[model samples]
Target: MKILVYNLKMNLDDTIYDLKKVTSKKIGVSERDFASFKIVKESIDARKKPHINIVYSVMVETDRKIRIPSKGDIRVLEDVLKKPFVYGSIKIRERPVVIGSGPAGLFASLILAQNGYKPLLLERGECVEKRTQIVNSFWAGGKLDEETNVQFGEGGAGTFSDGKLTTRINDKRSEMVLEEFYKSGAPEEILYKAKPHIGTDVLKKVVCNMRKRIIDLGGEVRFNAKVTDFLIKDGKIEGVKVNNYEEIHSQVVVLAIGHSARDTFEVLYNRGVKFVQKPFSIGVRIEHPQELINYAMYGDAAKHPRLGAADYQIFKKFSKRTVYSFCMCPGGVVVGAASEPETVLTNGMSEFARDRENANSALVVSVGPEDFENSHPLAGVEFQRRWERLAFQCGGRNYAAPVQRLGDFINGRVTRKLGSVKPSYTGKTEFSDLNYCLPPYVTDLLKKSIAFFDAKINGFGIEDAVLTGVETRTSSPVRILRDDNLEALDIRGLYPAGEGAGYAGGIVSAAVDGIRIAEKIMETYSNESL
Candidate 1:
């Protein structure tokens, strides 16, 4: 039997030996009998400022069952069992088709291929190698490739972001997802750290390795194959037409497109796939000096090498809207994330070292279905495009994003020039009023929230702090409706799988959703049918 223990605490300076010795004494075993243990989870308790501590949850292999202590910071950890996949009798005439090479599509394809169901994975943009070059060109003031930018690529939108592995969902598959990432060249710390992040630099290599492994497992991955049309016969999926010409047949289709696939969404909507308008957030990217954030989060201990750069999250509710921070990237730069031409949007990214000059986050306000001009499912998409277009025009009608100083924006005045803190946006950025981009109410809420957040963390609303225009792609604007079987309501073989389908948010959750969909497909079909 394996005994799992929780809430093992140690000082920040303590070593693994200290943890083992403490665990042995607490579990009422000699050091020799304790043998060894693995850290299942670890987190830093920095709430007490200078006096920080490292907390752990560990599992030890043992032959005897251990008793839970009556009092102390220890308890038996619960085991999470995954839903077993039971093969069914349905005949799968062809290999499964997974659209989009994001976490969801890749993971679903990986599982299917590993189980003898070779899957075809298609990505609209180029592979990571080409995609990285194309994105770098855009960032370096070259022409933007509308189809192969940050938002639509091999690693999905996450390829250019912080690559945060944290998810709010408590599903057991998260562990599986993390383990897979670790195997694919992600740092081993991700398996145990609380708020683990791979960083944009490391995630690129990790996803590339994941793709290679999928191919090694007999799965096929094709890039630059955008699904332009779906072939449906009597409410069942027959195949998908890619790049407007080539049609690939498959019995099952996993729609795992990322959030910025506006054209694909329209194609799906026009094909009569059921969709519902979903609430999504939109606002501006706010940036400040990384040192300011570190000082605020760690005080005088901000310079400690062990702590690294600091990040923060703040939320506030006003009248009809709730404003909060999203994708807080410490020591990061704001990047251009527009998938469509003549539009400007911003996202944040950081490298593994996180040693950039600025820290940025999406300080956004939530907007729901009611905020849309109409009840049509695509209304939110149109609404998002409106602000994006306005931001484009505001930024001199180029791919550059319009930026303003925090104080100037709050004061209802246009920013004529930048101050101490220069904008770190990848594409061009010009000093301008952000009011030309966002809704009036959203601007008002952001102004109030900045002050609210400033109280929580000093220097958050500093006069020279930069605010970039329009971060509309927070999540999917419409949810492709799916039933309990994880298939589209009216379409039999269409599985609406990830963020683009409004079923997941970040990398880890999307991967879990993909695993669940793959398991469901496995539970409903068997290879014998082929």
Candidate 2:
């Protein structure tokens, strides 16, 4: 019960040698002491090499004889309690259903299953491993699989993304999400890194492990089971209609369909669900050699084995409009993420090993109400489609993403040659005018942002840094409205809980919101005696 903070370098193996120095200090150990109980929370710092600091939390216990618990005893206790599943209860109907196997739904299903609720999960896309195979096929030979692509799938769009775990949330549930991820096959190092990421390679296994646990705990996961309609009666959701045919009944439904669920949005809107257009970002995936970024961040230290490849995020305010780096993947490659037949979307992904030859990032501009020509939720989708169409055209009608050299883009002149940094896109690169793909204003803003961001990171605005076209799926452009209690504002059982709901930004916050929504459902049932 004594919580302690131990900031020790991560590689400490000799606990006795290390702790002896701390606990070796003796107090009066005569019969005068009757099991004196006190806990000390001391600050400790560990090292990677000599000066690099790695910190940890440790709990200690001491007795009256001033006798310290043997390191083995402490380790045993810590190990025993470390994975303890607290008795957090929610008396829902024996089974609830979760839509979308993204991080939000996955974590919610895990907790609900652990807490004795046999939740059912539905995912529109294929499993992560299968989805990876399909996505790579498209990346390799330009074959697009609409159902199993990066945007839709067991792991959601985050699977193909940088897997950025950094969130703006400072909540206990967020910490729990990180801890659970570490437990469910994510690298342990992600638990402490300042900007933690579970590279696309590891995220596949991590998601699969979470799915296994859900199944082991009596939950069911149905992949490629698209929920086409929310079956509501008396203005309360009764269940979801899958694939427009089969109906699965459930009193509670967690909709984490993710930002890219455009088809689902259309289906729900027709089913009487209300939504509104919202702001999201639009831009292109820019690919550069990993060495370029490594050189820029570390300079001569770029050759240091410890640093690996570097990633960066830069931003600029252009006349009240903001242009920023959205997803930066180190040692990553630009993957073709197109779902529709004639559209192309670009996303960045790094392997768990992160040993790829290229580095990539999304330099995006915010698209908002101004982009909406008329008042329609799907208007934003149309807007996205238009740009995607142009991007596809920019690529010479192939799956190769449209590419524009920075020197051509910013200098208002097209270049026909390559420079120090090479393009890593498997697709073809065309040095064409970006205006054909992006809005004139958007491309102009981007040109200004490049010069502005140059001061922050070198080699950023270089002539050779490649700009691949149309990274439009920054986030959902429509928010399925939800009330303060997390349920849909108009529909009681319809809980819009994650990125698609406009309630969360990235993986951690989305997962945390999912847990909150699940807990809220449990609370509702508890209050109603359901």
Candidate 3:
């Protein structure tokens, strides 16, 4: 008999000498009755503070029949396996093309290649190997490559982020996404942890491995090949032109371009692709001491060796706006994410170890179409650009990020001296009034949110906490309208997927969206011939 167990708790210092014995004891059975034991999920329960417990859900196989207590956490194992994908019979003459190399595009192409679709994946930036070098040089104050900075790269903007895999969407495809990541150089812990993260350092290798697998399966990947134009005949995508030349013909095109592709968005809008302004958040990156956050979260167990760095998410609701903490990196640094020249923005990234001294997250407020000057579909883009340009100017127009102390920002005064916490931004930073770069309404709400957050996290609003300006790319400001079939509303064979299309929000969700899109394409066209 196979049995599943839940809510098994152990103290921080407790060590299991024999796992089979533990399971037998928990379920009121003998060790000899156990056939196999496996942990299904594990998480730290710090809600009790000083007395932290490790909670686990495990699956066990028993050699003999056992009577489970009717009210206990044990139950009969009834796992439902996912159904296999079925390919369609309609044959096509040309292979499918996937735009961008982010999580969505990569996974979408992987699905297509595995099923013999032989997709052509295109990226606007250099490959990961060279993209890493360029990003490092830019961090070291070298020239920024507008074509391939942190935003536009082989792995997309997510390559330089904290690489969090947590998402709010409840879909079965999510498990498939995690399995793929694990098979492609990601840590094993990601398979079962409550909140899994690959980190930027490890994620780069994972992405590269996935790309290689797609190629080995007979798919093609091209870097530094920006799609300049989309060929459409009577609202059906026929192909795409690369770099203002080199036309690649394909009947089906997946637009998985990431969120930072402003120029591509403009071209698509001009070409009459349906678009709608979407609500997104914008604000500055807040930095605080990692130790401070740990103490607040873990109390007396802050320094326990078993416990790693701590992370948090807090949000407050207002009458007309909502302020929240986003992309919280426990032990991470702020990074420059500028895809265009003369613009400045901030993002957060952490390594696998997460051993940095300070933690950072985006503290932003929500903005909608009503906030824009006009009802134009691209108004949000213009709104973001306006503040980004102002932030650039405030940072001395040299790629430096504008920063202010939390107290100074609250009091509406210019910060003069450094505090206990220092800014961990990768590029140059300038001390300036963040208010000047942000809208007056946003600044007002942010000031109020600090106190509300400080009450919950203890030192969240400490005087020394650094606030870096401006983080506008919380999500795509423009959502490319799509039909129930996941195709562009009017453009047949033009499928929009991932963050750039406003379909997904994070790495996992975007990858899941990509998988769904690939499945839809397979269902419509047969891969036996092309």
Candidate 2 lDDT tens digits, 425-459: 75556666676788887888998787677777777
lDDT of 1 by residue, 250-349 (tens): 8799999988888888898899899999999999999999999998888877887778999999999888889999999999999998878898999999
Q: Please report the TM-score between candidate 2 and the true structure.
A: 0.84
Q: Please give the clash total of every predicted structure, in order.
A: 0, 5, 0
| Candidate 1: residue pairs that collide | none
- Model 3 residue-pair collision total: 0
Off by over 4 Å in 1: 62-67, 76-84
Give the best candidate by lDDT: 3
**Number of backbone clashes in candidate 1:** 0
Better of 1 and 3 by TM-score: 3
User: Model 3, range 1-530, lDDT digits (tens) per residue?
Assistant: 78998888877776654445567788776766667777778789988898898877888887677787889898988767868877887887799999999999999999999989999999999999999999999988999898888988788899999999998999989999999999999998888788899899999999999999999999999999999999998989999999998999988999999888889999999899999999999999999999999998999899898789999999999999999999999899999988788899999999988999999999999999999889999899999999999999999999999999999999988899979999999999999999999999999999988888999999998999999999999999989999988999899999999999999999999999999999999999999897
Model 2: residues >4 Å from true position, as ranges?
1-94, 413-415, 426-428, 526-530
With a 3 Å backbone cut-off (N, CA, C), the pairs that clash in candidate 3 are: none
What are the runs in model 3 whose C-alpha is more than 4 Å off? 16-20, 69-71, 79-84
C-alpha lDDT of residue 498 in model 2: 87
Worst 10 residues of 2 by lDDT: 39-48
